[model samples]
Target: MKHADIKMAAEALFNERHNPLGAFSLGSETHRAVTIPDAVRRCRWIAVDINASAFGLFFVSPSPERARLVPCFDSDYPGVAVSTKFISGSNGEEMVHHTRDSTEPRWWTDDGSAAMNAMFGKLAWTGPMAPLAPGTSGIAFPVHADRGQCGLVVFTGSEIILKQDLLYEVHARCFSLFAAVARIRPSDAGRAHTISKRELECLKLTANGHTSEQIARTLKLSVHTANQYLTQSTQKLNAVNRNQAVAKALRLGLID
Candidate 1:
């Protein structure tokens, strides 16, 4: 999409934010579990809406002095590793340097300012360096978590359109999305917690598309018992639904 199309869509979204009966309810649904597929869909939708060619959600290590960029969900480049002192960096590369030496022309909000226009206006891309893409231009929303941990949700395209109101709306949505993902994310030390043996069995069965009755038949248990196990597994996984529970289990390697 062209920059003008991007600008027009952003402006519409910005205006919709103020509509009392607006249908955009992403910010209010953060309490739900966010599966990998769900996140990817949201990112893709946002990218298309804003005319971005790529979208990524990255976890920035809490250690500012030796920060690491862990790509959680990237449309263009998944699992790319990079390092930066995000707290002190002034330019793109200093802030976030990709492994292939791609320099990201980005805007930092670690300073706690919600004024995106002011922050964006300060960006100065000087000197010769590889763009994040062929002609990368994007916005990064920094999401701060507990204990100083943080992450970034970014949108990039060959030509990106930015408006202060639109950026603010996107930032709020990014924060909500990040929180939903964090709930299902495994602990830094590895698996956040464990499910019971029965719970695991039920979750695996669910992943295989087994209904409660089928699971009960397979396990030679009552349907009520099978459902109980599935419910317990869902609760233990911190998921809002069976599909989410199955997805989380698969991600944590608890089930194939």
Candidate 2:
């Protein structure tokens, strides 16, 4: 799809008011979610510009991947940059079963089951359908051919391939916005805002739908301490609440 057309469609669909087709839109800016629950509901699987270290979010305007409805803050997040790789075990790289012609995202279906199980153990969820296919999945695209950082905006779920070029452009742009919003958040600082590993442990449990008291019991810590850890973690992430903290933490690679 032409870039101009993609932008217009994205703007229309991402409005807070439901469009005629009633597709879900999480506002024009992704960071507006500000809470883990909101973020998760919007995109079940998300990672921000992953690398060996560091993590961050943002939004792309017009395309629904970056800006609009973004809170007035001094932060500058990332853009929708992508680096899609071709899988081929022949190159001493991991390979997957996919059609070479398609630019859509791919996941490990029954095709890569053995290797996936060896790497991650058996996944418990049946995904969106029955009889689970286990393994890892992510979206990648070869945008930005030459200069600059690969504008990475990472989010994943059971995304079916939309063969239309315009739709693909829309999908990619929306993710770019998600990344930008994240990148702009304040980076972790020294001691005062550093999130503890234990706190992170608690945060993951909480993300798994656990209550504060349950997390405390599971960790064998006082309820007050459990709550305190959550509060501190939330503050460290600059999140409005524990849920946002969890979402931010997840995006930041602070938790699984």
Candidate 3:
């Protein structure tokens, strides 16, 4: 697909967040697990686990149909943890309490004030849903436990409000599944690749079949610089070539 096509696809996906290509019983361990084939035909699923000090990517949907959310990233990237920080980083406001106390999930968007926008806007993201970190729209469902330790946070790209009745089942089940496996007060999540913001944008466009020159025009960067981003992303993803990098990025939930 082309860049513009991908953008339109994302808008459609966002609008249709409550409607899946397939139906589900809404009684599954995770939101994505509720579906037999895939939850959202065009979207990918990511699980975020929170602990005492840091957050990490617990799972990325292995669906072949789901596109990479970003071009050169996965759970192994440091920015994943940073995203959590941005969400829970409010002054004197602990994150766990936000989930432990509330039964309902809360909605968040990166399209807030300039400060909020800059916080999530800088990270690497791609795909039709490539609303990058500083600006990705999602709902946070916190996992509460009686243990009084850290709570888990399950962040999904889906707006999730439209199907509140149905999606709540999936979200509650996700909490149980996450609580069971989560470590109490664990150490930091391991190292992840660090790709620049511009590199990610370039890689996403490139994945949409834009050549160096086309990417340069769209992004208003020089062709040489556009190619440079691809090369850098290729190196960071440790892929043999740009094609391999795209595939790896998708599997890693970096691009879509």
Give stretches of model 1 more than 4 Å off.
1-27, 62-65, 76-93, 96-105, 108-135, 189-256
**Candidates in descending lDDT order:** 1, 3, 2
Q: Which stretches of candidate 2 lie over 4 Å from their true place?
A: 1-183, 186-193
The estimated TM-scores of all candidates read: 0.46, 0.32, 0.32
| Highest TM-score against the true fold, candidate | 1
Off by over 4 Å in 3: 1-74, 77-82, 91-95, 112-133, 156-162, 183-256
Ranking of candidates on TM-score, top first: 1, 3, 2
lDDT of 2 by residue, 32-100 (tens): 434433433333222222211111122111111111111111112222222111121121011111111
| C-alpha lDDT of all candidate models, in order | 0.55, 0.39, 0.42
lDDT string for model 3 (124-203, tens) is: 22112222245555544444332332233434332322232334443433343343333321111111136666777776
Alpha-carbon shift of residue 73 in model 2 (angstroms):
22
